[model samples]
Target chain A: MTVATFEASAPFHIPRWLAPFVVLSFAYIAVPFIGTNYLFEAILLPFLALSLAGVGLNILTGYAGQVSLGSAAFLAVGAFAAYNFNLRIEGLPLIGSIILSGFVAAAIGIVFGLPSLRLKGFYLAVSTLAAQFFVQWALTKFSWFSNDSASGVIDAPSLSIAGIAFNGAVGRYIFSLTIVSLLTFFAYRLVSSQTGRNFIAVRDNETAARIIGVPVLKTKLIAFAISSFIIGVAGVLWAFTYLRTVEPAGFNLDRSFQILFIIILGGLASIRGAFFGAALLVVSPLILSRLGSFLFGDLFNSGVLDMSQRIVLGALIILFLILEPDGLVSLWDRIRKRSVARLNKRKHVGRAAQPTQ
Target chain B: MSGFDWQFFVEVLIGGLLSGVMYSLVAIGFVLIYKTSGVLNFAQGAMLLFAALTFVSLVERGVPFALALIITFAVMVVIGIAIERVVLRPLTNRSPMTLFMATLGLSYILEGAAQLIWGTQVHGLDLGIDDVPFEVGGVLISQFDLFAAAIAAALVLFLSVFFRYTRVGLAFRAVADDQFAALAVGLRLPRIWATVWAVAGLVALVAGLLWGARLGVQFSLSLVVLKALPVLVLGGFDSIPGAIVGGLLIGATEKLAEVYIGEYFGGGTESWFAYVVALAFLLIRPSGIFGQKLVERV
Candidate 1:
């Protein structure tokens, strides 16, 4: 469909209820600058980086339908590559370094992704795990990646846009927000394009997609490349602006699995679900811990129950997958429709039920 | 020192075979579970650790080693039955991907629960058997390794007999081959599934004991089963014999790599050497040595 026709035919224009929500979210995202230094450093920046990583993964697993269990390895590639570029290039622009890191990550992702051409389903998962071990091993063993640091850790160089340093919490937060927002806008556009449709089509049915002229191999590889590139950039920001110093263990299987859980919890196919899922994975545990403390005082403390937290979380993931495979985004959609129906019911009586059907 | 030391080669080969037997024990548990449920039980390693911990603790608390081993096997049977009833039964007819995720979750739960029940500290397990290395024709070998290898061979032999000769075993293979067809012919699907899980648990208990005896019982003991994964990939997911052969191949190569190739890389190559073996096999024959090639009906 032409862009003009698509705009004209679109149903359910942005509702009044959602319009306020959008504006409020934007303000909340911007208003975090007023918080204390610890809150920004300890909370918001890491959360943003993790959420961006979640979005990058959702594009691959959720949209492209390739299950990746080694996303952390890609993130590590980005962070370490960006570090090397910044150190070696001498007068290299920061933006150029960040973009180059993504390209490096994409190259590594493709190398690991080659097995996917022959493997599928659970077999593919096991294969991806090799990437996790191999990359982590390299990071730990090859001291050059960490610049021969004593502890095998890399420290992010200070960020500068043409020598205007973003050194403080406020400056870093603004820089991260602008980059994440821009990347998110581009992701949204990409997901709606022909390439995106082809990915979803292949995901839904590879055979059917191939029959209909979708280049299966090219589409899958492109999805992997794009996904890794975005995740790599996020990793660069994660290290440079968020963590400041990173060890190999920080980007292991746990982070990859956590990101998978987030995307799955949010909604598989929806782009906006990335934030919802990231919020759950990142913030829900903290919220749950606080709630647990309030309810149980000192007896059933969060730390003691931390191990149990995994059991419960595992249970919840299975429960959500079984009961509501469409995830929290679908639940949100359902609630909005119901409320709209309830209001119309008072005005039109019996007509509301039919419209819902 | 000498041209082609015959005794050293024999010694390394024997050692490799012994370690391979232990790996096969774990892979066999994996094969049994995969055959019946069509789910790769990632928790097999964790189950091994849990079983080993339970066995050692019971023995440490004054139960005889023999009694502890038997009691642990029985407990495994019960645990297997519970898993089939509580976890697998509820999610019957879900997609394979969902089942895979559920198993992954189960692994986390099992690992955590094992740690909580048995403190995270490593404990030395004494099997009441001599571990001293003995020599035959100038080739020194540990009796513990030989005994473990013997036990593995005997277990596989018994399973082979049980599956091929017994009525219950026949039911298992029938169910594995075609669940719907077996059901159509008046077979009880749930009963067969329960039985298969019980057998898997029994194998896990034995595997756990031997592994713990060698490595010492700890939470990380579960990672050794990861060594079995490459075995599964190389042997094909469903082949029992493949598990045995794959295990041996991995065991020999891992040791050789650590001793030979690891010198160039400053050692620690054993941590991931087996995966490299599995990856190479996957690149060559993705279906595995004994696994049936998947023909997707497009």
Candidate 2:
């Protein structure tokens, strides 16, 4: 290979310029704790919960190459299961019940995942759609799933760990942050292990992976099991820490598509991309609605805003897919690389100008 | 002890079948697009809503009903051509997954655009067709139902003939089978795509007009149009006959479940019963009733 080829393939290194910005980001996240109740509860907590879900989905569709459209169904299952467990199993700790619900979700996820062995792509997608319909049906049919609540909604009691009650916004934010950080760390480690490599292999080519003794079916089932467990935990957190009272209608097909959009716009197959994608999905709508109201005032009410939002969102997705299929993460990477190259060029010019020095 | 009326059952059955025919009309739009483009137009249902809304709004403005319909149909056809030229052709080399996502986005875009242009409020649409119920042997059927069924059948027959014997139809089939081969033989792919989308638009117009007459023209039209999805799933994406058969089966079963088994679960099974049927079908016959058996090299 030529010298240029070797240089091009070299491992990407972060530039010094971005280091301070990365440090400041952590500081910004910490600022929320010092903020008032409204900001913490209404915004940051829910946003974090959504970010966790996005990351959970990133594990399945992004890393394992499974295109699931029934993610919201699993989220619903987790929420309801946790609610039931918390109510029925007397004196059970909240964390324990939530963890137990994850197992239930993983089991259901694996059963639904069995179809993946015989089908894939669009076929698999439709199969998952079945899961969405079935779960919603079961929820509506079996009133016990919603605890026979009059409105088909479930309310979870405040979570307490060893008598440290997380009852409000501040308690909830810390709880969410702690859980998200732990899960993210585990996800990072999981993605770096042998199991992760197998997942990538199976995703890249299942049949080839099978031929090469990668245990394709088992690896895929494992991916589904693990991914569902994470998603289930995220769901439990969402219902308990965020919404507080959950219903079947709240976790509908639109929610599923919204998650799918997050992953695609975040950058498929990248962990950090989930966070970025979630932030965009959450933030852009807020910004757009504000702008819409400012421009049109009362003329563009919620109904009109909703319609325009749908149109703009659709157009943006198509535009992004055509122009930047790799998504926002790749765009960030490209910008960073360009800046680094420019800096290097300046350094080289200065050295040449120094002559014998 | 038990006094069950057989005539009521017959009435519901006939009503269900007529609705099935209407669903088949919507499914046909999907079939034509899928067959020609190999992309499941998730927005097919939205197109129906848009066309019906446009037709109703035009007529409500004092335009002649017939003139409004023709004009609305032409507008839908133009939208079809625009979709092919602007959105689809650029996505030629992308994966089917990408195409699916694109169509989902397109569906959202169309629904939003429909709401924007036509307003979200519901509108009454009178098609100048018969609305009285027909009675025979103690059973009753709506005259509008018969009209819808007859119109759907006529449209399907016309489409079959168009695809089978026409020059453009031949070009469509040729392009569907292999794009590269069609190009080698000197077929203008863009032109073919445009024509196929236009035909799909016409099919959408017929379905929208009938369905809107039944349910009234409104934003909720998109929700009802989603029934086409389960139909497409069970019929196979690219199979026209499959769509007809699938739509009929879903219609019959969903109605039967709602009438008979709905009480067992406190009712409302009608909302998702067809999806359950399709899901079971997917488990049994994943390729669907008439879908081409997929051959994977790997």
Candidate 3:
């Protein structure tokens, strides 16, 4: 073997081209110069935050095989907890507040994850709704969470690290990109570990996993802790970096459904599926509105467009579940394989025709 | 605090139990679908909303009440059949979660379609019963609530009779008992499922109209399904009797909580108290009071 040749084997069969260097340059370097203000503010900011949350949910529901419909509640907990930490502590930095808030949310996630030890399937899913309603009610009922603002909306703390402040869309985007990257990298490592295998074992068959000496309860709890910690951080990005404000209403059940839809549309159990799903989710509404305006010429207003979006989204979920349960990533894989096969056939025919010239 | 007002407590309990029958109406829809197919139909709320919206919109256009009911029922039947044929059929044998998600998608479709067809305006439905509370022995009760309670009891009675005496009902029970065995014995799975879904849709219509009259026909009507989840958690996913009892317990407890302890929590505990009761029940009895015990085989 050549000296330059090295080999590596990971448990996950990552399909293709999740190159760190290429993606980093495109996000941090190339985009800053070429992209417009609106692109950074409206599109990339929320997209990045949702991508982070999607990754968090995928870790739990996708990898761990325990479904949750209470993600928005966790997001709210993170946002509010971070808000409180930053507000109450005299000189704690914004980043410290975020990390601490993530731990708080993780603690709560474990509390709710207790139910999963006893329940399964729809039972677990339905009970999680308790988190959704209870969180929303508590946040709204207790004015203390919002610093007695009376409006129940709290402004996010100013973002600054050491001597640098995230002042505008580009600055905030870059700041969020840093945290999301670091966290996503840890998550990427997590799924490829032995703990991740134990999760899959528990998911596929709990009896078998238990028989084989897997600490089933701990694995599930760990999954919940890690997933909620990540989701909590994503909530920090969502409120402070993306929306610039936090409220209980902002992280309602609809937001949870949106995040769940992301993992499902992206492809469950795949890291990149989260990104693909987040991208489709962020982009599709823009596409739908554009298509609506172009085709109907104001005959279909925003309300009608909104309704159509719901219809389209619902139809896509059903269609995907029926036709392609593996999600958009699998569909991309199919197209890529077809083109590669075609190129191989063409290359062989070209070699035969030229007679090895 | 003040000499233990038994009369006031009993009044609240009666009112809650009566309102719970309304919740039971919705929970029954969920129980029907879950029993036969093992799919907890999240779209039950959207179906409720759709049915109410359809009936209200038709009535507003001057259609007779009886005629509007028939047309709405027909629409629900069509929707049930379409769901069975299009979504559930292709998705058969999948995990319960997968099927549940499909129904979640189905809810979105139904909610959107309901609004698209009938514009998004809230309509006040008058069910022709006087709503003013009448007092009897220092206790007050509304006539509309009694009317609703009576209808629910009738529905329960009719449903039990149908399940006991009808051929399709026997097939439904067979499928619910064991789908594989039912298929082995030549039971028509699709038809039974279709029938069950139709019955669920009918239940939704009944719930929607009652809830619509109480709260108005609007998008929030779909949220009634959220209330039903706790009832299912309390009663079990498969038993109709469980749904009714659970709903009654949830209704009585939530109302009681709101009146007694809502102030300590700054009021508005009604939104989530049922879920808490149901969740506590789950910790003690996972299958529910009347639900079949699930024995998991390796």
Best-fitting candidate, scored by lDDT = 3
Top candidate on DockQ is: 3
RMSD of each: 3.4, 3.9, 3.7
Which scores better on TM-score, 2 or 3? Answer: 3
- Name the lDDT value of residue B116 in candidate 2: 96
Q: Which residue pairs in candidate 3 collide?
A: none
The candidate with the higher DockQ, 2 or 3, is: 3
Clashing pairs in 1: none
TM-score of each: 0.91, 0.91, 0.95
Candidate 1 lDDT over B184-272, as tens digits, reads 99998777777887888888888988999899999778887677887887787888999999888988887777765788987777667
For candidate 2, write residues A2-78 as lDDT tens digits.
12332443333454435535744563576555679866766777767777777878788878888888888888888
lDDT of 2 by residue, B182-235 (tens): 999999988898888888888888888888988898877776656777877788
Off by more than 4 A, model 2: A1-29, A33-38, A346-357, B1-10, B295-298
Ranking by DockQ: 3, 2, 1
* Candidate 3 error regions (>4 Å): A1-18, A347-357, B295-298
Task: Assess each model's interface with DockQ, reporting 2 decimals per model.
Answer: 0.46, 0.56, 0.64
How do the residues A1-357 of candidate 3 rate in per-residue lDDT, one tens digit apiece? 111111122212223344566898799999989989989888899999899999999999998998999999889999999999999999998889999999998998999899888887777888888888888999998899999987689898889999799968899999999999999889888988999888889888898999999999999999999999999999989999999877798898889999999999999988778888999999999999999899998888987887888889999899999999989888886775456545545666654432110
lDDT of each: 0.80, 0.81, 0.89
